[model samples]
Target: MSEGLSTRILDHIVHLSPPGTLEDSADAFRKLGFTVTPGGTHADGQTANALIIFADGTYLELLHFTHAPPASTAHPWAHKPPGWIDYAFLGNAGTPSVADTINRRAAADGSGVRYAPEVRGGRTRADDGRVLEWLITAPAPSEGNGTRASARGRLPFFCGDVTPREWRVPLEPRSNAEHASKARGVAYVKLLVLPSELDAYAKELTSVLGVSPAASSASQVVWELERQPSDSQPYQAPTLVLNAAEEYEEEIYVRERGAGIYELGVAVEDAGKAGVAYTPYGRVVWQAIGSR
Candidate 1:
C-alpha cells in the first residue's frame, strides 16, 4: 500500500456502453445536455469511453467496445465488465496506502465480505519530465472483511493520491468533441434502485465512499448535491436511488443485463433546461431531492 494517490471523494462514475458501439448512446448523452469528449482505444485494445467533465476534477466516463471483440487477455475492466458502470474517486499524495487502508476499514465494518485489493498502477512522465502517477482497484479485503476485489464488484472504493489544488485542469479526452456538447458538465447522477440489495448495497457504498446511505420511501432514494466542488456546482459524489424491486425486474434486467446500476448520475447545469433533452427517456424535471 503506497501513499501518493488521491482519494478525496468520488469525483465521478462511469457508464459502459455496449461493446463495439456507443455512437448512439454517445449521441443520447449529448442530447442529455452534456459536452461529450471523444475516447480512444484502451491499451489492451478492447473498448473506449467518451468523458463528461464537471467543474470538479471528477467526471463521468461512458465506456464501450470500439473495435473487434477484445481478446480475453485484456484488462478485466477494459473487457467491458458487466454492470451499469464504474466510478472514480479522488486520489492524491495524501492517500498513500489507500488500497491497504480501505481493505482494513471494510473488514472492521463487520459486513463479512473478505478480500484483498490489488493494484494496476504505473508511472509515466509528462513532457516536462514530471512523473504522472496513478493506481486503482478495490480496497483490500483485509480493510473490508478480506473480500477480493473482482471485476464488476459493487461499490468498490476508489482511492486517489491527487490533492484538491492540483485538479484544476481538464481530464484528457479519448476522441474529438462535437459542438453540441460544449456547454455540458455533470449536473448529478441517479441510481435506479437495487432494492433487494438496497440496504446491503448502501452499506457497502458508505464504507467505500465515506458517505452514509440516505433513507428511502418507495425504494427511491435521492441524494441531493450539497457541496459543488466543481464549476457546475454539483455535489461531489452525489448519487441517485431508484426502487430496485423484483417487481421492476424486467426494466432492471434490460438495463443491467444481470446486475444493477454500478452507479448512475447525470450531467447538467439546470435540470429544468435539460429536461427537454431528456424527455425521450422519461419525464424531465428539476425534481427536488434533499441534501443528506
Candidate 2:
C-alpha cells in the first residue's frame, strides 16, 4: 500500500427513517427545493431509498427499510435511529484499495479506525429496471469490549462503483438537477460529539479520510477537503465539521444518537430565498454559496 491513500471525494450522506416513511421523507425534501428521485430496494431486500442528487456528484440518500431484516442480520441500519445515520466517501478501483489504506493508517496511528473487508452491494432502480452495483467497505463490528468501535457510527465507510460512475449518476435534461429553492450542492456536513470525545474522534477521522485537521479547538474541529485553487471556479469541495455538543443551546443529537451527523449545510444562490425548515429527520442549514 502507498504510504498515504489517494484523496477520496464525498459521495453521499445517508438519512435513515422508519419503515413506510420513504414517501413522506421525499415529500419533505421536495418541499425544501430538492429533486428527490425514486430509489429501489437493496439487494438484501431489506431496505429502500430515495436520492437527492447534486451537480457536484455528491448526493443525499433518504433510506428506509421496506421491511425489517431478520433478527440475525448484522447490517448497520438494523439498529440505527432516525436521522443522518451515516455517510460514504468515494474509493479507488484497485488494490491496496482505499479501505485497506484506511485500516492500515488507522492501525499505524492506533486510532482504532478499522473497516470490514469490501463487499458487493447493489440495487435495482424502481422507476426503471436498471441495476446499479458497487463495492462497499463498512466499519468492522464491535467486540463488546470498552475500546472504541468504528461501528458506533462516527466514521464514514467507502464505496467504489463496479459499473461506470455516470451510469449510477445520470446527467440528462439538466432539469433533473434543478430545484425550486435554487439550491446547488452540499456545502458541508456537521457532526456533533461530546467535548470529551473530540480529540479521539478527530484523530480517527483524520486517519480514515487520509487528511489532516485544518482547525481544532475546544468547541470544534474542521477538516477541509483538498482542492486546487482556480480563478474560474469558486465553489470548492464540501467540508466535514465535528462540533462539541455541549456548546449547543438545544439538545445535542450526539447525546441521544451517539457521535453522528448532526446538521447538513447546503449551498444556495441566496440563503434568504432558501427558507429554513425542519424535517422529521433533522435540521438543514441553507447558506449562500462561498460563505464560510
Candidate 3:
C-alpha cells in the first residue's frame, strides 16, 4: 500500500512530443515571441527540453524524446501525437527530500492503482560551476516498457537543490525599449474530463496530490495545493488549480488528441508589445496581444 504524495512549489508545466521534434516546438514558441532558453536533456538519450521563463522564477517547459528506445516498435508519444506531456513543480532547498517522501507515500497508498516512483538526479552544469540538481518520480526504462506517453496522468515530481540560487542568469529583465512585458503568473491548469468521469478524475488528483477536496463549483472544480519553499522556513504561498469540464470546445480537440497541455494562462505587462513580438507565432492567446 502507498501513503500520499508530498510536493513543494509549482515550478513549471511540461509538454511531451516524440515524432514531433524539439526544433519544431522551439520554432512554434519563437513564432510566439517569448525567449525560449536552452534547458537540459534526459540521461536516457531519448529526450530534450526548452523553457519559457517568467518573472516569478516559474516557467513552462517543452519536452520531446529525440531518441526512442532502440527496440521500441510503437512510440507511446505517437499515440498522443503532439500536445502537453507532463508538468513539474520546483522544490525547497533545505532538507530537499520531497522526491523520496513522495515516492514513499505513493508506495504506501495503493500499488494496484498507483505506480512506483523512481528518483532521478545527477550533476548537470547549468552555469560555470553552477551545478543544477533536480529530482523526479518516474518509471524506469524497463517500467515504461519502451512506451513514451500515456493518459494515466503521470506522477507529479518535485525538484530541490542544496544551493538554491534564486537567479544565476537573470531572464532578460522586462524591457520597454524593445518589448515591454511583465509576468502576472499562471492562473490555472485546465484539463478535460468526460461528463461521467469528472468526479473520479477530481478524486484522483486530490488523493495523489494530498490536496483537500474541492469546495465546489458549477463551471469547474478547483483543487488547492500549498507549498513550502524550504524545509526549515515558510514564506509566500501560491496555489495551483486543476479544472475539469465536459463542455470546453478546446478540451474537445485536445482530449481527442490526448491528455496534454492545450493552452496556458499568462499575465503580461504590455499585451501590445507581447502581441507585436509574438506576431510570428500563429497568434497570442491574450485577445489584446493580437489587436494591440
Judged by TM-score, which candidate is best?
2
Query: Better model by lDDT, 1 or 2?
Result: 2
Model 3 residue 67 lDDT score: 61
Against the hidden true structure, what lDDT does model 2 obtain? 0.77
Question: What is the per-residue lDDT of model 1 for residues 1-292, given as tens digits with 9 covering 90 to 100?
Answer: 2243333355556666666556676677677656665544444445555566645445656666665564655354554443345555554443345555555655778554433444544322222333333445553323335753343434444534342323222444423222243333333444444456666655555555434546666456544333334444434445445355545544555355433342343443443433323422222233222222
How far does residue 106 in candidate 1 sit from its true spot (Å)? 1.6
Would you list the C-alpha lDDT of every candidate in the order shown?
0.46, 0.77, 0.48
Model 2 shows how many backbone clashes?
0
Which residue segments of model 1 deviate by more than 4 Å? 1-8, 22-25, 78-83, 93-95, 113-118, 121-133, 139-153, 157-188, 192-194, 214-237, 240-243, 246-259, 274-292
lDDT of 2 by residue, 1-292 (tens): 3754454467788998888789989998898778987778889888999888776667788999887666787677777888788988776454667767778888889998777788888888898878889888777865657763446457887777887765566544467667787777778888888888889989988887777888888888999864211112257678899988875542356777888888888888875755455778788888788677
Better TM-score candidate (1, 2): 2
Top candidate on lDDT is 2
Compose the digit string of candidate 3's lDDT tens values, residues 89-160. Answer: 654452434545544444565422243344445333333334454445442222346663343333345554
Q: Which stretches of candidate 3 lie above 4 Å from their native place?
A: 1-8, 17-20, 68-80, 91-115, 122-131, 139-155, 162-181, 225-239, 248-251, 254-260, 271-292
